[model samples]
Target: MLAIVLSAPVVLSDLYARRVPNAWLAATLLTAVAATLLQRLLGATPVVWPSLPGLVTGLVTMLPFYAIRWMGAGDVKFLATLGFLLGVRALLPIWIIGCLMTGVHAVCMLLFRLPRIAYAPGVSTVRQHLHASPLWQRSLHARQGRVGLPHAAYLGIAAIVTVLTPDLMHWEGA
Candidate 1:
């Protein structure tokens, strides 16, 4: 359930923001539920497919990030679903990689003149600016800039590592 917990924020953010594709979330959730039930009925060693609910949840959660221009909708769903399928144990590395990717993207945004605010230490000034600006105005003023790498690609790599090295989650004895 680690994956589910970790991915919850991303999926919920997406869903709250309405940035995710409904069909995709629905399909993933359905698949996961079915797979989990099957695994229990058949007495499988581990059930992986039911983890898709986490993925769906992640996708839905990512809508906020997407709306805020923090991440793409696809990235949110992909990582969340990946976490669910892999489980909490498999999510450690994925989170590490995702964080790294997010950092890199942030740095690139800073370098590339994306719609970001200049750093100001004064809380009063920041508050004043926020109050003066319209809700969507801030997003509008922020330029649509490019972050070289796609987050999904990084997530894919993380998923591969987690799947191949399941021991990372320390489930060896369990």
Candidate 2:
């Protein structure tokens, strides 16, 4: 889907630096907007649609986490922007799926005692480099504990899976 294609970088950035760059989000917004307009011009439902209620829903759903300082502002904004693009129908399922995945990740961390790579105590995120990241991902890093989960990564994964498999939350009918 177009949303998946556009959201990839934001997800990678979140995984890399525990951050979602505004540039990438802005790019996504612009692209979606352009695509929506074009789709309308063609007299069809926009594939890259936007939803005001979804935008609000995303912010409302995630704001509590941000207020607790458990989630970064980037994560919240990323979700909100994605909500705007993917619409309300998809956002809730994405959120539920992301939370479940994060729970699994936490359990794995506890079970395996995942090692955390330490860094200088006062290193800035802007100056940090992804030295340990793979050759293809020599692009991002930050001070992160192994126990902490980057919600954006999980949410991005959820969004992709939800879009690809829309019946994920409709199993009740089965």
- Model 1 CA deviation exceeding 4 Å by range: 1-29, 41-49, 52-64, 101-148, 171-174
Q: Model 2 compared with the native: what TM-score?
A: 0.72
Candidate 2 lDDT by residue in tens digits, 72-135: 8887988888798878778878888888988897786565443332333333332244344364
For 105-161, candidate 1 gives per-residue lDDT tens digits of: 669667544323444446446657876878535433432343334555566556666
What are the lDDT scores of the predictions, listed in order?
Answer: 0.57, 0.74
Residue 98, model 1, lDDT: 62
Query: Candidate 1, 47: how far from true, in Å?
Result: 2.1
Best by lDDT: 2
Highest-scoring model, TM-score:
2
Summed backbone clashes in each candidate are 23, 0
